[model samples]
Target: MTRKASGAPGQDGHDDLQRNLTNRHIQLIAIGGAIGTGLFMGSGKTISLAGPSIVFVYMAIGIMLFFVMRAMGELLLSNLQYRSFIDFSADLLGPWAGFFTGWTYWFCWIVTGIADVIAITGYAQFWFPDIPQWLPAIACVLVLLGLNLLTVKLFGETEFWFAMIKIVAIVTLIGVGLCMVFSGFVSPAGRQASLANLWNDGGMFPNGLMGFFAGFQIAVFAFVGIELVGTTAAEAKDPERTLPRAINSIPVRIIVFYVLALVAIMAVTPWRDVVPGKSPFVELFVLAGLPAAAGVINFVVLTSAASSANSGVFSTSRMLYGLSLKGDAPKSFGTLSSRSVPSRGLMFSCICLLAGAFLMWMIPDLMEAFTLVTTVSAILFMFVWSLILLSYIAYRRQRAALHQASRFKMPGGVPMCVACLAFFAGILVLLTLKDDTRQALIVTPLWFVLLGVAYQFVRRRAVAGVVAIQ
Candidate 1:
């Protein structure tokens, strides 16, 4: 996501997000963005696709995006003027660039929000067998609406606690699983849990080169929201310090949180038996002989869903508010309540998510909802990531002089940019091979097409109005 400088002057000297989001909020919000339903529920699919090599797929994507964040950080810190990626897109690539970046990122959250709704119902089923799924789905939407409509700090606070729950769960699982791996704890099923399990099931990429590449298809989606740090620059206090800390440590984050987590999961439960269609975490707890495993995990997954949807609401509203200020969206979206929050934008995004939940219930099977939500979320991520590439290209062309002064410049420069873009393009190709992802791949471009048409209208009006004044 390319961002323009947010410090640009407006008639009122202050745009919508004037107050600084607290330190606790920024840190937890960062965690909130990093963890998602993808880790809890979706990891099984990647394992199934590439066996133990799923770890490699995640690491590869995480590494590439670490570079992207470096590039974004350099630009953002250079001026601290940009509010978000779309803001940078405008400054570097021009107005239309911001329009597309803003809206595309907006779609990213919407798709994610729908997926959260899908997950909530699934979790609810584990607790209430007789309850109709849609009942909880509707309830989740209302909860998200009220949570988001409060204050930005409240949003951050909510995310902080939600993320705290997820982090604690992962850390506990990792610590406990490590003990079992070292203690030689044998499973009740007569299987010994060991680190050797990493390669025991055919040595990493058991399915060969083809399986490794296929893992990329779902793996890319797993890291979709990792760059959300860049988007929060608008509200972050001491962003120069906070942003760099978050982006620089991504490599460590991947190893500790994702790679290690997966390694432990597979070690406890062999790859062959790990249910591809269900959460391997939940299954492992059950394997560990915990009768309450299902209930404990059900709670974890529910909070994970709330965390993701909460983030979606926060981001989508900001994107709209940013778009409106740039004159691409309806003016009302730019309006803030007395609380300095973009209340209209908040309400609008949540309402759209509510509508999406209703549409999801119309589907026959719950699993299909997961595929559909993930596919569209992946596509939205593709667009947002593509914009970051284009923004880098634009930054190089427009501000060559700043390369040296750039506080956090991207290393390897254009070469690295080209390579990362190519990596993303390859993943896009992989999406086509899976029929489920392919539908989203085909339909996603239509969103950009529609945005392009709307942009033309807005651009023409701005041009004509300026001409008349002259």
Candidate 2:
């Protein structure tokens, strides 16, 4: 997919999107984006699947994804005119690459948004048990849509606070867990609090090869939004400075948020006892003789889900807007509101998201449907990520001078891209081992098939128009 060195279309380093995102906003957005509901809620399921080895799962995924982020950061900073990887894909790979990458990324977020809305409804049930689940789901979507429609800065501020709550909660949890470990606190189950809990029961890989492999299925979903910072390049006031700083801190964030937080939870309560569906964080707090903290943790998890959903709306609309600018989607989507927001695209995505939420409501088997939706989302996200890596490969091969000129060049370069791609492939293979994910893996191809068909029609129409003009 490499191309000759050529300037990208609309390569002026300016756009309709307002560059109001300062370094602080970008930094927090990166942090907020990386920390998702998956950590707060989904980790319970992952812990159950992989036992104590879930720590390794988070670390491995973080390392591989950090490389992916490095590749993305290099590509984005290579040319300031490139809004995101989607733009670079178009320029470096081809229009079809851009179309597929943009739309697949959009679809990924929409599916994720559906999951978040459902999670939000479940969380709302804690306070209002009598209320229908659908009510909170609808209210959440509507409210987030309204807020996002106002301004991009508002989205940043919202995520900033949402991420702060999560950070505070984790810090508190870690502090409490440390105290318990040092003071020799014991859980009600008589499980002594100790760091050895990570491997004492049956070693780190207690679940053996199969269980560790199975953990990847759920753990990969936890990292869906890790690349979200790249999307903000267009709106970032100083992408070169802000994007690098945000990306460079990924290892540290992963250590604190994912690794340390999970370690704390498992140490306080044995991984074998961690409920699959229930939140471990909430349980740990309750075990520590602070039942009220369960509600507070619930609120944090609720906000975390909302933040991810809010991000879904923001990212999906922007992706659609970028696609439209490339003549890959309806022109209406490219139109920006007076506030420079992609209102039309945002509304369209919200409508589709509402439809998804409605379908989830109508379905009798919620868990079954959710499993399929999430698996599909994860697969599509992998495709989008692969495209970014592929685009980076093309950028490096075709634009040699550009690579040499880059200050934030990807560390491992092509070998790292190949490794990440291999890792993603390994995840797909692991998906085939489970019945739940296997079904989604089987059905996931239909999406790419549809995209291929759409591309052919788009290409035919494009050729016909070009001939008609001639």
Candidate that would win on lDDT: 2
Q: Per-residue lDDT tens digits of candidate 2, residues 1-470?
A: 11111123334447778787888888888888788787887899999889988889989989989999999999988888887889999999999999999989999999999999998998899999999877898899899999998888988888788888878998999999999999999877789999999988999988898999989998888888888998889988788899999999999999998999999999988899999988899898888899597789889999989989988999999999898877788878888888878898999999888899988888898888888888898899999889989999999899999999999989989999999999999999999998989999999899889999999998898899899999
Give candidate 1's whole-model lDDT: 0.81
Error of 2 at 426 (Å): 0.5
User: Please, what are the lDDT tens digits per residue for candidate 1 over residues 353-408?
Assistant: 87887887778885776786787888788778778877887888888888777777
Give the whole-model CA lDDT for all candidates, comma-separated: 0.81, 0.88
Predict model 2's lDDT versus the native: 0.88
Candidate 2 local Cα displacement, residue 446, angstroms: 0.5
- Report backbone clashes per prediction: 12, 0
TM per prediction: 0.94, 0.96
